[model samples]
Target chain A: MTATVSYVPAPDAAPRSRMLGAQTRMELRLLLRNGEQVGLTLVVPLLLEVFLNLPLLSSLGGSRRIDFVVPSVLALAVMSSAFTGLAIGTGFERKYGVLKRLGATALPRSVLLLGKTLAVLLLEVLQVGLVCTLGLALGWHPHGNPIWTALLIVLGTLAFGGLGLLIAGTLRAEVTLAAANLIWLVLLFAGGIAIALDSYPAPFADVARYLPSAALSDGLHHVLQNGGGLPLGAALTLLVWSAVALPAATRWFSWE
Target chain B: MPPQATHAILAPSRPDEAASGPALEISGLIKSYAGRRVVDGLTLTLARGEIVALLGPNGAGKTTTIEISEGFRRPDAGTVRVLGLDPLRDAAALKPQIGVMLQDGVGAYTGAKARELLDLFAAYAAHPHDTAELLELVGLSDVAGTQVKRLSGGQRQRLSLALALVGRPALVFLDEPTAGMDPQARRGTWGLISQLRADGVSVVLTTHLLDEAEQLADTIVVINHGRVVATGSPAELVRAGAEGQIRFRAPAGLRLTSLSDALHAGASASEEAPGRYLITGERSPQLLASVAAWCAAQGVFAEDLAVERRTLEDVFLEMTGAELSA
Candidate 1:
């Protein structure tokens, strides 16, 4: 066959920002479309927020049950989306060769990780908006600086998101699925989200407060429920988790 | 076949870089897995716009060699240069120029819609082919909205092919490109691959289908036991050291002594079965004429007379000592 056009021999990568944006959007779209993820990230948090506020359950002494329930549920939202949802989703993506395919593209590995983090962050924003709206409709009143709440949310996400990816990248899909759910359940009941940390015996509460989930929940509860200043102790715990987990994930994460 | 000559003829209008060197160059490539050498000191070069097929039996290191070239696996020893740049050291610069389709559905997002998946890959390139046009080219336009996991094996293979082209890559590495495809889809893919060559794209593909190698590759490399046993054009490999035979059906048990004398000294005749005769010799017009002339002299007509040249499959089996599919 005769050549119709000269070979240009020019193959340039797209701008980094464009690649990150496209990957983030694709990741978020898949996260939202998955029925189980949506239920876990959004619907379940909203349901728990309402369910725990009912008078049928024995209420802890509080100014208003809505205030306490709202903060705890917000913390729960962060954990479910950033840890459980992200873990299950990424585990299956690895199992199905999705990450292997992406490895061949021009998109950098850092960009892929950042894109998934950004997608998780975006989903958290939606979750926060919905949970806050319902809290307001239920006459919940929150105090403390909004910036503290934002900081806790962001750092909590990175900490949990990093750990989630570590599990997904290193373990089999079915194992990750089971472990993530089991961890979520264990943390929900014992990690100061569904129950106040003080309610636990002194020895148990001491260790429970160090858990990432408990740190997030307690930090949010101190700021949003008690109108307190920055909870430095809880913030430090989350910061340490993020510092350790992110690098471990970056070092050990396998594409296949 | 003088691949450089073929490259010059097919892509005469290409720029200086296209003429400067081969599209891919590998020297003394060696890779091992778990104490076993999967690819042992293999060397190959591919010219611009040439389609080279890596033909081998199972565990012959075709996939390992391709993976090293694609930069997915590191070589234990040797050098690999794709588009005149190191695949690992210069990967950021090289990845955009080379597309890859891995084996066993390793290159697609299972949860993504076909269109979305293509669009996502396209976003990684500065200038990409239109998604609709690419899908149409691969005959996957009808299933663009379907999730990748929901598509049939053939549809997924075509979608993978479409992904490899969306970036307008200069070279593409396709592993088993048509393994799960139907005959019609496979034909469409072959046409698309040929079009890629026409448009000045280099292709390196690994396949068990010897017919695919013979039908599409400009040069065929037959490898066995992690080493290249033979490398040549399809016609050249078939013609290399493989004798031609002429077979015919005639009345059995006829005296063949005179018939053998009528033909050349090197030729021999045999009747191993009832009413069947076989002639082993160099195939030529003179030999054919002698056979016809001898039959007439003996007042016997030869039925089902035909000349048979060695096929690529036969050559491959002889080289590999294993079936292609095994």
Candidate 2:
């Protein structure tokens, strides 16, 4: 047996980030490997986008369905990854005592939350790319400034992700499950998706158009369908909503 | 099998400021759920390198106390110091110095491997134990690749222990660590705990099993109805509760009163059954010899003669006024 020569450094010199980075890497790897998260965040959204924009829906409404479905489905993708995925995932985590175990360690809570958020963001980005690719391939020309479109996507991600955290953190797993699914349904149907708020009677449309989910859909649709510039007001409104909801939700997220 | 060797590994590699102080000092700990007080006015201190078993029946404030000590719950009005740092106020600084294995209540159990969980926890500590070494120590080396949810109950318990030790904490808190395990599994856990002690890690464990406390604890604190009923070494608590009781079936024709009178001369005796009697005294030799002589003088033999020493169960029964099992 041969002993390998080892270099020994002076004691008390290693930076904490070296250790934290290693742990974060492992956490990221585990997260990417989860089948359900991948299915819900990536596969489901891609299928829904492609399926809704097929010749059947386009022929019925002359591409208006495709125009409406693109932005609304993006909303669905965000909801699935940020809210439903996190809520169900965190719920199961509480059930198994994973949060409690993590809390017991010296790892900063900020790092833990950040790691989870980053993983969700990575999936969200992938979702955006897939949806964009399908929209481009299906002869839907997005005639807006690429920079403005990028800004809208970022704002929408922040808003929905914040709302999702609020739901996952504050509500019980069962309640979060029901509420997230319910919210998704409401946004899909009544949130100015297939039917425009302007097409509605009067006051309801005026109010519904300002909702974060509705604003995101309207902003994205304006850019993709009408070659319109980014609606700075609606984007800011969504940003403000996220700023408020994200902090509150993150503050109250329960490990158990 | 002893406690000091592994503790040497668990002990901080760098100098610690609170080395001379108590391992844990908890004072006036109070926690309330809704309007009910769960833990109230509890104060206790654990010394360095000692194993203290907290024994209590269900809903006896053990969870609340342990949680507060671990910096998980804020006390309504109390102070808790782990390694001399206030657990709640200085949790970040104190956390690295302690290892806490809560009852596997938080979810981190996707299909990720056990080694992955260990690595994650090891990241939380300043100087985590080697991941492979920790897995082997916890008896999960063979199944390192198995997902956490796929592990059996005993295997999960072992994984939980490994996660807790990843930081090589100076003090380890184990809550009902061996609740459901076969004899072999239980013994394996005991061996690991023994190994931890040999390494110098102070362990505070809560268990309903008296035998576990008897076998593992250097000191036992029994709590009932949200208060500490008795605190001492296991043998002391038991010996203080009941100095060995002796029971025997005397001759059928013998008068119960006469037998009691004769046995009472040597020790306290009472007829517990039709022809059976129980005797208790401070000294075993004097008590047994007198019983034997009386039986011989009566030309009768005693049947089912049994002498029992004080046990942790007896102490728990005496303090709580409820059977340990019940």
Chain A: TM-score in each candidate? 0.96, 0.80
N/CA/C clash count, model 2? 22
- Residue-level lDDT of model 1, residues B1-326, one tens digit each, is 22233333333223565457798898999998999999998998899889999999879999999988888889999999987878889887778888889888735668789999999999998767668877877778889999998999888888988788777788999999998999998887887788888767899999999889988999998988788889999999999987778889888887788888998979888886988988878888888999999999889989999899878887888887788772
TM-score result, candidate 1:
0.92
Query: Mind giving the per-residue lDDT tens digits that candidate 1 earns over A109-154?
Result: 8899889999999999999999999999999898999999999999
Q: Per-residue error at B125 for model 1, in Å?
A: 0.4
Q: Report residue B288 deviation for candidate 1 (angstroms).
A: 2.2
- Interface RMSD of candidate 1, in Å, is 6.1
Best by DockQ: 1
Q: Can you write out model 2's per-residue Cα lDDT over A1-256, one digit (the tens) per residue?
A: 0111111111111245754575456655655688877777778777877777765643324255566666767766776776677666766666556677667777677777666676666766778788878877765565677677667767777777778777767777788778877886787667765456666678888888878777877887777666788787779888898898888877887866
List, residue by residue over B106-211, the lDDT tens digit for candidate 2.
1465567888777766666544566887677657899999888788878888787877676667789999887666678788888778676765678999988888
Chain A of candidate 2 gets a TM-score of 0.80
DockQ of 1: 0.47
Show the lowest summed lDDT stretch of 10 residues, model 2 chain B: B1-10
Q: TM-score each candidate.
A: 0.92, 0.88
Q: Give candidate 1 regions above 4 Å deviation.
A: A1-9, B1-19, B250-262, B270-275, B293-301
